[model samples]
Target: MALSVVDLYRDILPKTNCGDCGFPTCLAFAGMVVSEKHPIDGCPHLAPEVVERCNQELAEQYAAGKWTKRDLAEDALTWAKERSASMNLSDLPGRIGGELLDTDSGKALKLPYFGGHVIISEGDITRADDRELTRWEKVFIYNHLSQGGSRMPIGKWKGFEEFPNTVSKIKTMAGHVEAPLVDRFHGRLAELVDAAKRIGGMEMTGKAHSADAAFFFRPFLRVPVMLLFWDEDPADGFGATAKLLFDETVIEHLDIESIVFLSERLRQLLCDAADEAPQKGNT
Candidate 1:
């Protein structure tokens, strides 16, 4: 195998995204290297021996042919695909909540996605309707298959930031997901609720939670998320706040980065659905 960015991101580089590598994130740095934009040894965190190993691999790869920029794109997905390839296909359904289907080519796992379903077969993964998935959606799917999480949702929810190695992603979550949501639906929580339902979010009503609106979204079969939003109340000098929570078993289902990507997709879907829905004038 060539020394692809996937190898660097998942195996060689420190996943901390510590910024000591000149680029802001490890994925960025890996992409930079794959495009020959930077040296492989740019990351100071890597051991000299590790750097030497990567250099040897890259040298051999370069001798073979050029690596395309597109190849470097979506290192997470590449890593996930590589992981899925190494996994035992038969073991997937037992771990994740999916049905093993017999396709003419090979085995496929039919897993739930939001309310729809996706078929995961070697070299070919698509929605039940066969609609092409976005890059993020592909990452979300492959990450689920790669992890092969066996535990069901624990029925208890906690903030996404509580997960290990997620401290760096907290700001990302707040800025990209939370802030936009609060701005768009602050005093219009009713609209927010409608948007949630549009995206297959189940209203978790009669539940004891601090948020004014609560929804449970099973974005992936074994990976469910609780979206809690505190509507703005100007009378109390409070601003709208939002948080996406996960079951206690989330850490076992997907890595921290995938969890953040999943949330970003949720934000995009919710915002789009809200824009399309008919508005309610007032409560």
Candidate 2:
């Protein structure tokens, strides 16, 4: 079996939590190395032979297609399909607020969504209008199916820190999801709104929060997320800030890891849209 990053790191590193790698701990350094943010040789404690072996193992795993995202997605899909095979497709609509419809292919669960209607049946997902499902959509649907929760959304919103076991990940979540958004569209509220609309996000008004802008996006049938932004105030010396809020029931539909994945995907979509927009003085 191919070793996981943790496994590889544990096998090669001294496991001493040494700060010699310029990180607070060796584990932190290992994480950076796995993410390709740091070179393997950055750990001065590692001997030449250990570094050579670690590099060789990484290369072998890559050659064997063990660490590819596609491979992981396929594995997750397979596991989800197995779990879904025993589920009652008819009951999912009531549980998750979707509609059961008879299609030419067969009966499928349809959920009206931002981009299009998402149709799910027997572990497969497709657009209701016969369009292709994006990769992110497929993964999201699979995770939704695998989780198989019966609770309905209560319309109560909470930040990631409030989710189960997510208090420790709040910083990571903010860095990955909110920071990038603030960096890309800090003062450009109109452009951000336009990008959000292109991705099927709806502007929400009259919310309790004193945000400069707020929008709602439904990434899945029952998973509603809210994005709020606070522009910088030079007089007050407050920097631009962005935050993501999830319905309290979000944990029922998808795990925290998958939630992070969706957030990152959202950030990517907004950034890509921003990049494609016409620049000043450009045709």
Clashing pairs in 2: none
Q: State the TM-score for model 2.
A: 0.67
lDDT: worst 10-residue window of model 2? 274-283
- Report the C-alpha displacement of residue 83, candidate 1, in angstroms: 1.5
Which stretches in model 2 have alpha-carbon errors above 4 Å? 1-70, 129-136, 276-283
Tens digits of lDDT, candidate 2, 177-266: 899999988777777877787788888845767888788888776788898988887899999898899999898888787788778878
Local distance difference test, each candidate? 0.83, 0.76
User: If scored against the real structure, what TM-score would every candidate get?
Assistant: 0.73, 0.67
Highest lDDT model number: 1
lDDT (10s digit) by residue, model 1, range 35-109? 663788889888899888888877777666557444433676777788778876678877887889999988888
